[model samples]
Target: MRGDAETTRATGSPPALRRGACPTLAAPMQTGDGLLARLRPASGFFTAAAFLDLLDAAEAFGSGRLDITARGNLQIRGLRAESVAPLSAAVARAGIVPCEGIAVEVPPLAGLDPSEWADPRPLARKLAERIADSGLDLAPKLAVIVDGGGRLHLDGVAADIKLVAGAADPRPVWHLLVAGRPTGVSGSVDAMIEAAMSVVADIAAYGSAARARDLPAEPLPPGSSSLALREAAMSPVGRFDLGASVVLGVAPAFGQMAAHIVRPLILAAVAEGVSAVRLAPGRAILLVGPAGWNTSVLVSLAASLGFVVHAGDPALRIDACAGQAGCASGRIDTHAVASHLIAHAPALMDGSLDLHVSGCAKGCARPRVADLTLVAMSCDGRPGLSIVLGGRAGDSPVATKRLEDGPSAITALGQRVAETVEKGESAAACLQRLGPARIAAAFSAARFNGIDHAGL
Candidate 1:
């Protein structure tokens, strides 16, 4: 399947979705079961009825399971082949417009962040709508960012045009980021969008056929030009001040939530006057509107709804792909084991930790480093689990080491991690203070049989 084929549909005509070899549809794709509807969420804002329409569509066309891609878009799978037209209409009725141009991403709280000099969502809408409305005759690999004042940064994600908002000016100055690097400054959103549109024209005329990363190729395409750069005035606000990781880190049991549960969650958040509700990459909902609301009540509502509340709970950092029944590639029910480990979270977290539960070895949920990783495999006619730990992310990152395999007990595994961390050490001490050698041994013994799993 060619990547261009998949991307073409995103820029294809409405009503009739183009055919592509890519398994994931940029436009709608019909199979015997249903149409896989790929939605484009530019600013991540949807009406309440529109939100419920998604619930209805999932129930009507798909398998009642919605997949949130890493790019912050929603994918509906398992739809009846005949339901394509109605499904598309339903999505349109739900207020999600199919974007036909470059994808743009920004901080979830771009508009409402109090610390930001300007709201980026309204302007982001202008940029996207302009590109679509202008009927630009060129395909450009362009992306833009509007950084809000909050600490929820957008770094790991790639972008072509990034507009950071917190500059020294009284009004937010828009700095045009080209190829993930700053290119120029503009006081007006219109001017910023115009500059990016020019970059798109350059791509169309010059033959910068590859993504921004592939710029090293010689004999560069037809049109290529250097862009002027600009600097943003730094503010006094701390960079990581985006509060907790609670935005998208919270997950529901089985990664499932009913309309009753979901609506109330949105209402609770809306009552606090949140600006928008974004489907997070972590397969969770991020309610962004205003700050300083009743944290306890929100936590209570989410907990009551059967979501594993991560509010202030540093231990619940593990994640998994849809394993077993949910995915054809999965070999085990990773969600079940992850749930079991989470229940005994107090015994699992050694200082701060992150884990990933991959069904087979595909590891779709996360590709980056984690403190612990549990990869599933079958061995010796029995289901076995592989354990890896001591991985890190960001600068000087490392992947977890595979320490054990064979039917390891999840609870025992949790206890082993906890016991290793609480070695009469201060909370501020680094995770390695527990001694990597000791943690490795505990994992080894537990995989074979050190701790009991009577109830499990």
Candidate 2:
């Protein structure tokens, strides 16, 4: 399997995880890749040295593949059962500690953003610590997001409890929300944490299975006022000015960074006088450096190291899972097919459309809706793809077609789709015009033709 390092070589396979449990550095879960260990960096930031140490540890103890998960957590794949203990120990020695209890996420530039209403890091840390000490039986995957009303927002990401900084009304306060719904408001951070703890306590008293959303409706706290809720925009990729300094956000293709490139990238950032490296939402690595540093040179170096330096890069629109190469459940080469699609239909990455090439229905790459989703499947013992339109990977397929002899077939199909869009038809409009039946027929026919074929 992918994450099971030497364990797969020695024992053939590692033990599977208990249902509903997420893999951690201390207790990894067995996957098709072996054992997968997920490490949540303390404070969501890593120094250049610490980042290099993590990369080294991953390459040494696990498979050389490192992934930044959608939630900004780091994952090391291809580990053996025996390697888990050593990897965990090495990570500790490297000063990388996983966040325990319910996951509490804040904005990547929480404390640094000048336009933010408040610095959310201290409040987030307090909540995490309190939740851990509360001894309340919380679900492992349950999470909270503390939005400081900053430029880099966490609104798009869902959380069990959301604490958004209230707009300035001559006094600082926070709006306490349960599952994104307004519950109450607090004048101070301590009051906000207290209100959240009360809700958690209620859930604990009810049952372990109860979530924040399951709690009965309650009145807002006395003297609390309601304010219009607005989600801030996220722009973590590319160059952005922070005060007098410049911060560059770099993302690896498909959020997967090979071990070899990690050290070089971090070293290059450090060479540019980067003081801090933060993991942002959307799998972006934020490098904070002085304004005098040569951002263009750093961008070039990062691009050379296989990192996406530009927000408009074509790779940004493609989300692919580790296919047959790394995932056992995968039936097709997701990355290969995605590359072909992007090469043939460059406009698919024009920022208007989103494409998710999932290795399987599990949709590990992207679980949410996309403009186009290609789910890998097997048809009559031959690799094929089930195309899902206007939905997610696990959603029912709109059309299905078997892969032809070579990449030409896939390219031809992609070209045809691109042609349809080129003729002033939006992707959604084209899908609506063709419908599922015709879409499938077009792909099936294109598979028999070559790259020159068009007219889907």
Each model's Cα RMSD: 8.1, 4.7
The clash count for each model shown is 14, 19
Task: Please give, for residues 1-456, the per-residue lDDT of candidate 2 as tens digits.
Answer: 225434444564444554666787655777678788887787678876778888888888888888887877888998887677677667778777677557789988887777788888889899988998888877777778888877787877888788888777675588777876777565689988998888778777767766777877777778667856565565578887777667889998888878898778778788889977788877888898886556898888888888888776777777888877777777777777777777766645556677888888888888778888888766578766777877888898755676553255455556666767647667666656667777666555655444422212
Worst 10 contiguous positions by lDDT, candidate 1: 232-241
CA error at residue 144 for candidate 2, angstroms: 0.4
Give the per-residue Cα lDDT of candidate 2 at 125: 90
Candidate 1 residues lying further than 4 Å off, grouped into runs, are 1-36, 69-71, 129-143, 151-160, 176-191, 194-209, 216-276, 280-283, 286-299, 308-310, 314-316, 343-351, 369-371, 380-382, 388-442, 447-456
lDDT of 1 by residue, 1-456 (tens): 235443443544223453322233334555333455666554465654477777787777667766555545666666654554456667777777655565566665455455556666777777767666766543333555665434344554567556665464456566655566544345567777777676655555554343444333234234433333223322111111244312323445534444556667767766766545565444456654443444567767777887766533432356676676566666667766576566754565443566777676656566566766777654445555665554321212122222233335455545655655556653224345655455545545544444433212
RMSD of 2: 4.7
